[model samples]
Every structure is written in structure tokens, then in C-alpha cells.
Target: MLSPNSVYTSKKLGHYIVTILTIIAGSTVVATQINLGNRYRGFTITQLISSYNIFCSIILTSQFVCSVLELWSRFRTLNGQLLESLSCVGRPGLSQLLLGWRKRGNGEDLAARLRRLQHVHLVLQRAAELLQAHVSPAVTFHLMYSVVGIIYGSYELLVVSQAQNRAESMIISPSTSYSLCWLVHHLFDLVALTVSCSILEDEEMQASVLLRRAVGIEETVPQVEAFLRQIKRGPAICFTASGLLPIDRRLLVSAVSAATTYLIVLGQFGLR
Candidate 1:
């Protein structure tokens, strides 16, 4: 009993799921080859896998830090605007005190308070933006990384196969790896999307209440829906621009393809 919109959304979600699975499968194949080659050259599978994870972690962490700084800068700008707005209004209910404080009191103290508020506001704003930008995508990335790790870890199977001179019996086919990786990625993305959507709905409800109070108009469902759509702008921009840029996608695919081919070749060689 799904509506047309619901059906379309489900189809779209399925497509993303397939894409992520392909990425995982490709990564696994590459990783397996890399690990096997290292092993053949006298490195243990554990050593190769550990080094790979360490490298990936460093890259991911650097990206995360840069994202945080960009978000922080945006928040600071927003907060400066809020403080400037407040300063223009100037000590709203205490006209006499304002004159006295502006002259006799340390102007520095008032400036400091304003600055502190600005900083606090900026930090809060940045945290909110970070949550909006990262929550779902981070979950998706983590899930994808986990699949990569698990499949890569399972190269121990290949190692054993090589050791026993039975590498052909334990080949990790691309399709098999891709299927498992895709399943994991899709499930994780679904969970992340559901949680993010729920939070967005709650935010929309709050915004509707505020709008109703300020404008003295009852908020209609359509109005609330429109507001919710507006809120999605940030996530949409982040995904399109920051999360899945063409360069990043190309690099990831290239790496996965290279790795998978290498592993297949190694498996064949080891069997001989």
C-alpha cells in the first residue's frame, strides 16, 4: 500500500545501497590482493592490514578535522551577527544604567560579556551545523569502513589458502564480497536516514510552534512541510558538494578496482 512518492523514494534508496555495495566489493578485492602480495614478500597479513587501517584512519581524521573547522567558522560568523544585532539594541530596559555603565563603568567589561556570549553562541551554532552535516553521512561512512575492514580482515582466509597451496579453493570473488558489503551498507544507511529524518521532523514541529507564536497564525501542515524542506537544504548541499564529490568517487573506484584485480591475480599465482 505504498504511495507513488514512497515507492520512488524506496527505489532511490535501493540505488544508493547498490552503489555502496559496489564500492565495498571493489575495496575488499583490492585489499585482499595488497595483503597477499605483502605476505608473499614476507610481511604478515596482520601487519599489512594494520598498516592499511592506520593509513585510512589518518586520512579520515584529517578530513573530519577540516570539516569541523569550516563549520566552526560559519558559526562564528553567525554569532558575530547576533551580537552585533544585540549591541545595536543596547541595554533595552535600563536607559539610566546604560548611560552610567557606558561612561563610568569599564566599557571593557561589557565588551567582554558580549564577546563571551558571541563565542558561546558561535560554538553552539557550529555544533548544530556539525550534527546536521555529519550525523547521517558519518554513520554511512563508518558502516562502509566497517565492511571494508571485515572483508579485508577475512583475507586471513586467503592467507590460509596460500599457505596450504589451495588458494583456488578460497578465492574471494568480487560478486560475493560486493553482495555482503552492499547489504551492510544499505542497512546502515537506512538506519542513519531514519534517525536523521526523525530529528528533522522534531525540529520542524518546534519551528512551527515558534512561527505560530510570533506571527499569531495557526501553522498548517503544508507550511510545516515547506519549512522542513528548507531545513533539508544544508544536508543536500553537504552531500552534493562535500560528501560525494566526483573526484572523491573517482579516486575510490579506481583504488577499489586496482586492489580487486591485484588480489585475483595473486590468488591465481599462489595456487600455482
Candidate 2:
């Protein structure tokens, strides 16, 4: 059986966490904008637009994040169960040594076990593909949303820093804080999504390794060989953002580099 950690046991924990964070962050953003609205009474239209934008962004980000968390939990359970099933077959080396001494029936039993594992792996692969398809669209939109928020926030922070000497520093400070807060939230979501997917990818790689080891080098059973061939020839089961980018640590590195470059360009423009 899979361990408790393999599956997400807390059924509503993700929902609770997302809801609590959304309320806190959403409230802070709205309240900050309202305070700024009062301070700058002349910019009524600007204040309303800002509030609307922030509200919509928060709602969309929250929805996507929650969906990802839920799907991730399901994926974790499926992966864990697969690993557990593989483990039940025991080590290939040990099985080989023991089966040689036992009755011929033991060899048949080992072959049966290998076939079952192959079936289980195929089922899990199908499930992962389905989950990937379900989440790709949301992931794509969330990524675009986050990138835009990060760019805008970075630019606003730069502008606010230059406003320190202005009479409206009080107004600028709150807006900057809101932007910074929004920026951090987006970064957190991106990091969490990528990290979770990376973990799953690593686990799947290990499982594939284990499957090969269990099959061993000397065994010539056609069923087992076919299973190995399937693993080698098949595409890797992993998450991708709208089938465009794999969700992994590499994506994080690229994202950070791109965001930094954009910020630098924005900074240069602000200076000019």
C-alpha cells in the first residue's frame, strides 16, 4: 500500500489555503487602492480602473492556482500507487537467484508479476495524459497572466522609487506595496506549479529506472522485453504548459531571466 505522504489526505486543505490567501490578498489590494482613491480624489476614473484590474487578476489567479493544486494532488496519488505496485515485485536480482532454486512455477509467477506491472504502468500513463490535457489550458493562461503582472509591478516599483521626493509619496507608497504584493503572489504561484511538476517528473524517472532494474539484463521473456521496449520507445509522461513548455526548473530559470531583462528595459525607459 502507498504511504500517507504519497496521497494528499487532507481533502479540503487546498481549498482552505487558497480561499484564505485569496481573501487576505484580495482585501489588501482593494483596501490599498481605496485608500489611494481617497487621497487622489481627482483621479476617480483611474482609481476605479485600477481596482477593477486588480480584482479581476486576483480572481483569475486564484481559480487557476486552486485547479493546479487539486490536479497535482490527484497526480501524486496515482504516482505513489504505481510505485507501490512496482515495489511489490521485489528486487530483480533477488528474484532471479531465488527463482532459479525454486520450482518452475515460481518463474511463471515472476512473469505474471512483470505483466501486471506493465499493465499498471500503462493505466497510470493514460491517467497522467488525461490530467495533463485537462490542466494545460489553465496553465497557459495563468502563465501569461503572471508574466504581465510581474512586468507591470516591476515597472511600477521603479517609478515609485523615483517618486520618493514628490509630494505624493504617501499615495505612491501604498500603490507600490500593492504592486509588490501582487508580484510576489504571482511568483509564488509560478514557482509552486513548476516545483510540483518537477517533483512528479523526478519520481516518474525513478520509477522507470526501477522497472528496468526489476526486469534485469539476462531475462529474455518476450513479455518483459516488450515492456522494456515500450518504456524506451514511448514519450515521457510529464506536464507541459499548453504543450508549449515543460513545467520544470528549467522553465523557472528562463522565466526569471526574461523578467529581469524586461525590467531592465522598462527601467531604461523610465530613466529616459
Candidate 3:
């Protein structure tokens, strides 16, 4: 469905360019930090994790973006094919006017269209399986790094802010600026990931709705019911992080709540 046409070409090109630029930026930042002895020169554990927080955030964000793109590409194709298949419903008028009514064996034409729909459904199911399998591990890594980054980064920022409040004059260091940017990057990364999974869920819901329509059309075809029944029996394509966390807006809300709670607890205990 997404062939090398203008719409597809332009969209793909833009995403690729952005991804490349992000990769270069992340790599350059890490290299600079190491060369400037910001972390690599007999770094303490805190400094090491601090460095890792940025590096992992970048890596995981890129992986999530790529995975989301791939999944979206497949689902878009599925949606297009689904529309084509739906045309077989002969909802009257448009399809008949375009191709003209078949004067020959009408049953054969209907059967062929039904078969095409079945084939497309099979392809969609296969794609959904592959997408889930490929992205699950990456999602798990993203979630893990996200939790660590949020908690640790928030602690660092809170302590620094408090110190600055007590100081007569605030002096900003390169590391401090980098840390601030790092925290912002984590926020962006989390939002990006949350949106990506939400889109996947939406696509799956679209497919389900299409199948339900097919079930409705079963009144006429009677045969499409078999195919629809098969699909309906299986679980819908649900994206989860390492089979534990469901990727949804609820996950995003809960993660924020949990992070905030922990940060407060850490502050109370005088995390140093």
C-alpha cells in the first residue's frame, strides 16, 4: 500500500533525516563528555550512571522511534488493504459503476474477492505478530532506562535547585547544563514512546473495527464469517514491554505517579 509514491517518499525521507541527525547528536555529546573527562576519568558510580542515563536514553529513544515507524508502516499497509477488501462488500454504486456489473458467473467474482480479503487478513496477522515480537525487548529496555533516568535525574535536579537557592550567586557549569538537557531529553523520550504505542493500539483497534464490519457483511456473503470468526477468536495485537507492562496512556500516567512518589520519599530520606 505504501509504495514509492510522493506521499510515501517524502514522509520516509523526513523521518530518516531526523533519525540520522539525532543519532549524530547523541553520539557527539557522549564522545565530548568522555574526552573532556566529565565522566570517563576515574568516574564514580554516580557519575557512571549519570553518563549512562544520557547514553541509554538516546539509544532507547532511537530504537523506539525506529520500531514504531516499522510497525506503523505495516499497519498502514494493512489499513489500505482492508479498504480494498471492504470494497468487495458491493455496498452498491461506486464499485459497480467503476468496473461495471459482471455479466458472467457472479458467484466466482464474489468468491475471488472473498479469497483476497482472507489473504490480506492473514498478512495483517503475520505483521502484527512480527511487530510485537521485534519491539517487545526494545520497549522493555526503554521502560527500564526511563524509570532510572526519571528518578535519578529528578533527584539531581532537586538537590541542585535547593543548593542554588541557598547560594549567594549561582554559577552554571557545563555539566550542569548537560544534566538539565539530559532531563529534558528523558521527558521528550517518554512522550515519544507513549505516543508511539498509543498509535499502535489505535491501529489495532481500527483492524478490529474493520473485521466487525466484515462480520456485518457476513449476512450477505455468509462465507466471510468463517474468516472473521477465526480472527476474533485470537487475542488482538497488544503491545507490551517485555510481557509485563501494557504500553498505553495509563502506563504513562502511572509511571509519572510512581516516579513522583519515589522522588518525594528519596528527598525525605535525605538522598545524598
Candidate 4:
């Protein structure tokens, strides 16, 4: 049984983790961009444009992360509440059993509780829908950005590594360093996004398992029957990017595979 306090503590921890990671990523990108700019003389137009581009990208990425984190926190709270409700439904107090006017009265009490939990489940679904609606566009754009960035950045690194001998490549290229940093940053962001969604999906599964157990309790009610039906017939309890791309470990896997394939093709073209 998950306590509300524990859920709140976990949410605070997640906030700290996200904040620290965002700082590190943003700093690394800024540092690399500065290093690259130092190579050019007189703070030229090209350098100005490059700096502006990096700034904008960092800002947008940070905004997307913040949005996702907020939604993730809400989902965690609702998940915890659902679990708590389901657990209580499974176990009733001994006092309630002894003092009830009759078994029928006790059964009615349990049915009412189940009905309330059913309401909670409905609210949870609504929260999920709200989250999806608000973040789907941003998520879709982020996914596309990550795919393109990884493919191009990987290609650039490969070209640099190939063009220079080991010693020269190891010691001489700011561009190589920048590309490597950018790739790491993008990959980290993508992994974080996918992991967050995966965790929420796992929570949904946990709730379903608890609900199934609740079905076997001695005082089964129509609410329980309808609850099971709702679980089956309701919209899939999973996250998606614009209802087009499912955001999960599988998305991460497919993104990496596609990037690798494109990188290989680009390498072949460069060789030719």
C-alpha cells in the first residue's frame, strides 16, 4: 500500500533529479558552444548566428522537459491514490465487520466504497487524457527533433573521425567535441522522456493487477463488474505523442535503430 506522503516525497525527488540533470545538460551545451565560438575570430556573424541557434534549442528543450515533468508528477499522484483505493477495497476493518447492523449492511458499505473508487478511476482517466492533450504536440516535435539531431550529429562525428588521424582527431577538433556533446545531450533527453512514460505505464499495470485481485474478494458488486469491463473497453492506458507515436521503451529502440540505419547510409554516401 502506497501512502500519499511517500508519493509526495517521490515527486519532490523527481523534481530535484530533473533540475540537476537539466542544469548539467544546459551547461555542457553552453560550454561546448563557447569552446567552438572561441575558435573563430572577432565574434563574426556566423558565430552570432550559431550562438543564437544553440540558445533557442536549449530553451525549447528545457520547456519541453518542464512540461513533461509537471504532467508526470500529476500522473504519479493519481496512480498512488488509485492504488491506495484499490488496497482499501481489498481489506475492510474488523470493527466495521463486528459493529455493522448486519452482513447486508457491511456489504453495502463495501459496495459504496467500490463505487467511490470507480469514480477515482474515472478521474484518473481524465487526468491522463488532459496530459496527453497538453503535451502531445510538444512530444511529437521533440521526438522528431531528437531523430534528426542524432542522425546528423552521428554523421558529423563519423566524418570527423574518418578525416583525421587518431592523434589529430583526439587532440585537434572542437567540432568533434561539440558534436559528441550534442549527441550525448540529445540521447539523454530522449532516454529520460521514454523512461518517464515507461514508469507511468508500469504503474497502470500495477493498478490493474490490484484491481483484478479486488475482483476475487467475497463481496463482489456490480461496480466491480463494471470496473473490469471499463478496464477492457476503455481507451488504452498508455502515453502517446499526438496519438501517432507511442512513447515508451519501444519508441526509444525504434528511434535508435532508425538513426543508426540513416547514419550508415550517410556514411556510404560520404565514402562514395
Question: Which pairs of residues have clashing backbones in candidate 4?
Answer: none
Provide TM-scores for the models: 0.28, 0.69, 0.69, 0.73
Candidate 2 lDDT: 0.62
- What would you estimate as the lDDT of candidate 1? 0.41
lDDT of each model, Cα atoms only?
A: 0.41, 0.62, 0.61, 0.63
* Pick by lDDT: 1 or 2, better one: 2
How well is each residue in 13-96 modelled by candidate 3, as lDDT tens digits? 447745753764465456446534553465456555556665665666666666665666666666555555555665445444
Shift in Å, residue 96, candidate 4? 21
- Tell me the tens digit of each residue's lDDT in model 4 across 163-234: 554423333233666777777767866777787678666755655555565566534556667767777777
TM-score of 2: 0.69
> So what's the TM-score on candidate 1?
0.28
Angstrom error at residue 235, model 4: 1.3
80: Cα error in model 4, Å: 5.6
Tens digit of per-residue lDDT, candidate 2, span 1-272: 23466335433655665665576567656755666666776557766775676566566555544554544554455444433434334455575453331321234355566676667667667766777787678677777777666676676677677654542543344466566776776676676667656765675565456557546644655665676787788777778888788988888888888888988986787545
lDDT of 1 by residue, 103-188 (tens): 22322354344445435443544565565566445545654554454345345345553454543345433333433443344333
From the highest TM-score down, the ranking of the candidates is 4, 2, 3, 1
